[model samples]
Target: MKKNRFLIILTISVGLFLLSFSLSYQLITNKSEDNKIAKIENNKLENDDKNVEIIKEEEKVSPNTIIEQRILYKECGDLIVTNQTPSTDIINMTKEKYENYLTNKKPFLRVISFSSNKIVTWGEKEHLCNKHFIIGEEDGKIAVFKIGEDGERLLHKIFVDYPVELLMELDRDEIKKGIRVDSEEELSDVLENFIS
Candidate 1:
């Protein structure tokens, strides 16, 4: 009888342990799936796209055709640029910060600025510069450009909120050039000047 009682208790304990482990594993797996679903939903929101407009015959026109071309600008955040040309380390750091900032509600971005470059972003406003300096905006993500006196240029984006100390050391220039043109032809001219 004593032997039987000991065996029964041991079997019950092992069964309970296995059951608890399986339950915990399932819970964790379900939580991960839920997180993934949330991410997918957010991505859909980010990619909110519209149809493109192309001049064509009346027969080609459809109700779904977008009449007014829309340039979906990327959401902006509070970010500043620096005078330093970005290195591999800076790129990695900036990319990580950008990702983090995008995942959060509001984040500041600190970007290293360089001389003479045109940086393009999907953000609300297009920012341009020729001098090595920093520009700050209320928008979180900023693309940085550095163009040299020789007309060489590079483009990079800052995706995260960094400390002010890193950006404070650099100089800032606010002189605005022709960033917003009324027509696409003028935009091309502006871009040409930027690259040249």
Candidate 2:
């Protein structure tokens, strides 16, 4: 009877040891699956960062693009071409209208039509127009240009300091005061800089 009891206890201990080993194996397998899930989540986060970087690159737009878009929407009569076709009878009338229109107190950079109603003005700020349009530069002494409607395609410096109501009025008189008469040599130097 003593021997039989010892054998029964030994068998129970072996069974308990086997059960503990199986539980540990299951725990290790579960931990490995959790690590795999964590790795997948980390990869997803990295992909999200790459997508954000691409979106930022697409958002960066050039200044010229913004200016042209504004021109399309704004009432720009300053860029109107004086000579329009299909108006053989009204040609003289159109010229008279343009001349009377330009009898303002300040200089005009460009004029745009306001949806066929009236002309809109531009270049009221010294650098605003240049910064936006990038067409021309101050002739060191003075900036001058004879503008018409059709030259919109031509990239010229836009003078933004003109009056909103009248293209003749300037925002500041300092621009004129700063002008100095260029000598023939100075003029040649300025011309060379532009030509090159």
Candidate 3:
């Protein structure tokens, strides 16, 4: 009976120690898993910061370097490609920003792109006829255009908040499609259709 009591006590002690060890191992494993997750999150944040830095670098422009530059000018039926030395202002702007400012903009474009020694820019104003520019009514306002040699009008300028009543007074097809004149003075004469 004494031997049996000793054996039973020994068996209970062994079981309790094994239970405690198993619980400690489970806790260690959970802590390791949590640490791994934290490291992964930190790496992701670092990568995101690096990506933003890269984008900022890409947007930076050298302020003093002279790059190849050119303008695509429309003359009559021909496209005249003009190569030019870039100004300090042009060198300061990124091509995408300059292009945005000039896309559908007037007078002359700021810059287009850079490739093959031709820095890019363009403004399509027709030159085949004597008229340097044309004017007409469109989208509820007076607008001006540059015609290609193909005689297709390209948007050049627009008038905002032009009187609706004055626009209604115009029925002349020449003023509606466009008026061709030799200079800005003649262009204004045609513009009279939209005015008093």
Q: What is the C-alpha RMSD of each candidate to the true structure, in Å?
A: 27.8, 20.3, 15.7
Candidate 2 Cα errors over 4 Å, as ranges:
53-196
Error of 1 at 72 (Å): 48
lDDT of each: 0.39, 0.40, 0.62
Better of 2 and 3 by TM-score: 3
Q: Write the per-residue lDDT of candidate 3 for residues 57-157, one digit (tens) a residue.
A: 44324543334433333454545555456555555566675566456443455644543234555556534443468776677667888766455677877
Sort the candidates on TM-score, descending order. 3, 2, 1
Candidate 2 whole-model C-alpha lDDT, 0 to 1: 0.40
Report the Cα lDDT for candidate 1: 0.39
Which residue segments of model 3 deviate by more than 4 Å? 1-76, 88-106, 113-119, 128-196
Ranking by lDDT: 3, 2, 1
Higher-scoring candidate on lDDT, 1 or 3:
3
